[model samples]
Target: MACSNLGHTGVTYTGKEDLRETLYELCQSPTITSPTGGDNVAGYIDGTEFKFYKSDNLARPAVVNALLGKAKSNYATVYTNRADALWIKHYPKMKVKLMDQLKPTEGDGAVGVTLALQTVKKWPRQIAAIALKAPIPGGGLHAAAAGLSKDLDLPPGSRKKGLARALRYYMLATYSLVDISSAEAYEGLKNYVGALLVSDQGQILAAGINTGSFRHAEVSMLLSYFRNNPTATKVPENSVIFSTLTPCKGCTGFLSVTKSSNCVIYFGQEDTGKDGKVGKKISTQLSEKTKAPVGRSKEKLPGEIVPDDTEDTEGTGVVAMGTASEIHKVQVDKGLTSCMGTGSIATQIGKAKHAKEVLRSGSEALIHKMLRTRATDAESEVKHAVLTHIGQWLGTSRSVE
Candidate 1:
């Protein structure tokens, strides 16, 4: 859960409301000369400067303390106050370069530098790439394995690189959990895909099966989680997604919507002879449809997203990356919620029960503790709704189907 934005300097001061006063004086100061090499810079606050310097361990900077509810110490701690929350750590020192420094010229109290900080932690880095070659539509297990092996850029070896590596990485990283889509669940759906959203560290952000024949499992989890969770900030940011079957039109199209830039490993390989990898095909088509002049209006096209109204047939088509004009015909069933709403907990395992207790107690180690425990299975729409509700509460989505 590392944030990709950060090396930015921060503001420091004695207390709350003090930072503002300090900034006001700093801005109005004639000591810091206004920018020159121009004709006429007519304004009380024409330009400003921002400098990044190593922070002191003495006390929490006013800005930092206010943002992060930590002790009044700016010193970096090894742990975090909020569980499942990503925090920032500042770098020691670096050369400070003022890039296009400017300030507002409004009437009263218009001060402070228009600035942003860069991170020393270059995030969004690829940690691992897993390729799953499970049986999928239009391809069998053998076809997928061969295709995946041939398409993979790994050194020549067996077809288990992604799978084995993922498992081993999971074992090595103990702060992990594995969510499983139980075989006993979601019996009504047919020709639907299933996936386990695993991180290298055994954490399972989601275990989901497709809502029905048309909706992809990945799409189901993403939409449900993102829509329900009020703050869509916490998520599996940099981990790769490993799916048993090759991604189809529905699931592949969701990459952009989910903000999913991580490496995606699925079972199907391109025909190689002609069809190309499924990833490549989808990327090409999506690119063609989504291309537009930069800086153009940000208005979304008709089909760019699966409409919020799942009841409307118009929104039930393929949602390509940024483009969504072309409508693919699809069969719709009664909405997912109404279909799978009958489950009740049969026999709750102690550990899973305890995890729920921790959830109730509001422990920060929510997902980590839940992953280690086991739970009994019960199939009903009610059960599914309850699990989905818990997953959202934990900042993710979960469902039997």
Candidate 2:
């Protein structure tokens, strides 16, 4: 949620102090004097005081605020109260034509792909919020992504190029750099992207440039830029900071499996030697910590926001086999797994929660069974009633199974 400082009527008052100061300033403003001299001076002063008092009372900050109401408006109207209100002026909307072009035909795979493309192409600004990954929507964003491979006439392992193209378009759209349909802009886009991808500045460039030719000096230049500002090899935990050389045990088997056999520990900015540190022999997993200040130990306790989304067992890495803390670590690690592990989000969502609710309802293993099963009229009515009840509790209109 974005916060704003000013209110309507172009007033600069935010709260108590600003309101008082504004009122004081208004009071000290130039006063009108009587043209008729001495006799009318007192009357003029009285009239001025009355007018000032009336205006102050009528436009009192509390009253002005009460009339304004909570903003509760759409994104377009959201940032009007901020000090730098004009910054919101440049925000672009989803291109209506591009969106119309993506309208689904019978809602099949092509439609899905078109929708994904349209979505990414239009509001590329949203990509960061959703995380900088492929915008594969329902039925898999990758399914349509293959179209790029076919369109480019590339062979296997050419998916990355298509992915890169999509990413380039996405970045440009997000920054409002240029319109995608312009041919010259697209060509420039190609060169710019080529430069960024193989450059040391890019994370994927290091692993991807083995096959491409070296004619493009832009690629090498980018590689040099990345080398200078090398991407961090280690991502910090969300909530907690891992102190150097701390013997933090793995919470679960998955925690142990997620890390490489050798872990690299950096203290401040420098990597120091910790004799016989766990990273030297075996991989050590660190649980996420709060964003500092919460625990104050630099080490956050378990349950900090995991960097990765929990999806399923397949890519869940190995579960740690140790004490309760180890098991807890595994549990936390599972939360870091991606949601794209399996076919259905419902199933994957359950796995993300460790199948706990599913097991409690005896619905974990029964997912397939429930899908295959049919309902009688009476059962349907009862299910509808139950769904309604649950929906009321959840403040949703979701159908119950």
Candidate 3:
């Protein structure tokens, strides 16, 4: 596939297969303070972090990131982050939209197009405490989300149906990028996801990405972990599962059966047609709206400091809040940290002994097992902090209990 950026046609994709399916994900970022001293260029995927000198080299170091197949995902972050540094402004990359098309060839003429890169101008990432990707809401949030719990008044006429709908259902939203292929298998490098299961009070439960045996669906693997694992099974029924992409009907049904109230998908709705345009279009619209973080808008609820409705917009990345250690605790460090609400988070843990064995045995199939363990911890640390802050914010902002 030919990739053209800024209207400059350059670089044909050099790979065996082009991505057949449209991909999506949700990026729940912990708000980091802008680099304090200077241009401190760093990037992290999953738990691994990379530092770079040249902005262009940012993508080169991302070889360690598990979810990103090639250099592009990290590269996009670097490109956008560095651009923000240079401009002295925050510009967030909302999403990467891939479009495939056929162009003229010399002799064989028509070639099967595999992959093309498109940068969505409006999908922003924030230091989110509770980011539910295209998530299905739990009893409370689900009721709120379905416009069942309360009356929702949306702005009228060409206001973007998605933006209004999201605001009506939620106070916050974020996004992610994914690589989709025709084959329904994980090929070590593509068609996987990064997942985290977190409670409303901010504790890590289970986390995994589509790796090893998990090539096709992350939601299934996450559900399996929650159901089968001794520790995760105890997660509060009110807890929510976060996935980088939207879950299929089967997986969503499974989540429903498991009694887990919410499964927030970061990406798009599943496609109804064979061509897959409908879902992709909706994803694009939602991402576009989420690219810029909504602030002090007319959407704010009465007597609230922040808006009643929080949505994303295009072209703005976020800075994480909190201290360096606090940032790193959840940002990079693995394995549970700090009590959430009840202070008995330690008791909430699954079998720590069994977790150690998974790490020690260290087989190929068990790679994701260890990954799930550590990533779950890492995501929980940050998410808890984020949730804690959100809780505090809600307390201070809302007069009623």
Candidate 4:
């Protein structure tokens, strides 16, 4: 195998070798599974030589020792997360460089992994195509603002503004991932929807996307949150969840059972069944079941209100002012969300076709629009927040110098 050096410190140029297969093998190997009873493994690739490491957890000494002892210079390491995504970390410094989720190409289980690997290996050059800088249609910022204003026709207030801002972030994150998926030639990129669990303070707790499987976007987001914060059993109170498309029945049920968020907001309504009616009904029922907090007045008093320092927002799933959380359905014009939801049925039909090209073009266009769009202080803040949330998955710092 010919390996080209990209002239960058931590970037590994493995000429035309799709390492997803090797990653899947290591993940399923007995060494990693026997010790941890889980399919978690790590691999280091130097030249044509591949070294596999097994660890029960991220901090396992055996894997660390393998990396420290064996890896010397110019190598790439890959690891599998709880979400079955393959993350490539450049070695020597050990910073995550890239990642791709293993799709069920052939069948549901391990067979899918095999088929996906084979598919990637077969079209290495195509998968390695460079991203094109394309123009976005309808003007990125203008379209986004117009969509939010028209869709979420709520009384002008902070809540409406906040929801609109969060939706922008969600759309950006979703399109960004789609761009990556397109670069990697992942099938069904158009059907991808992004989900975010955000705190009342506007910090993103966890970010997730639909894997085109049983794990919907909402479910994946919750899983990522719990994986990152193992001690957290449920979502924090006053936290909101934003989904690019309205969740299905399965996702709504999971969110309700888990008490996933105080408020659930969605951009595009799903065409299946009653649009967002089911989710709204379920969320309303949950909110009604929740009792008002004691000692806090449900109605606002006419006097100057002092912030309560002792108020618990941890596990109570209550909103401020002793009110229950609500579900909001934004009515977006035919836009990015609709584009994303298309070809989902095709994805379900044995991957017969995908919307990768459409999604990639759309994503690039949106990105271009965003770049050309004038940036307000608030827009800058939202962009920074989105970058920070994505940075959690893609490491923030470069590999150790």
Predictions in order: lDDT? 0.27, 0.20, 0.27, 0.38
The better-scoring model by lDDT among 3 and 4 is: 4
TM-score of 3: 0.27
Residues 222-284 of candidate 1: C-alpha lDDT, one tens digit per residue: 433443342563335543343323455445545444534543343211212221254454332
Candidate 2 lDDT by residue in tens digits, 127-205? 0111122122121112222233344433333433323232222211111111111111212222111111211111212
The true-versus-predicted C-alpha distance at residue 335 of model 3, in Å, is: 33
Order of the predicted models by TM-score, top scorer first: 4, 3, 1, 2
lDDT of 2 at 390: 23
Q: Write the per-residue lDDT of candidate 4 for residues 21-113, one digit (tens) a residue.
A: 443343344434453455344444444434433333332212333333333534344333332221112122343311134332432112211
Return the lDDT, model 1, position 372. 33
Candidate 3 structure quality by residue, lDDT tens digits, 1-401:
23311111232333234321111110101111233322222332211212122122221211112113324344333212233221112112322111111123321113233233332221111112223232212223322223322343433322232223332112221111111111122344433333345444333343433433212233433433433352443335544444434443333433444435443333322233332342242222123232212122122212212121333111222221222222222211022213212222211112122211111111111111112222133333332334333333222221100
Show the lowest summed lDDT stretch of 10 residues, model 3.
21-30
**Candidate 3 CA-lDDT value:** 0.27
Stretches > 4 Å off in candidate 1: 1-164, 167-189, 227-229, 233-235, 268-401
Clashes of each: 27, 25, 41, 1
In terms of lDDT, the best-performing candidate is 4
Name the weakest run of 10 consecutive residues (lDDT summed) in model 1.
326-335
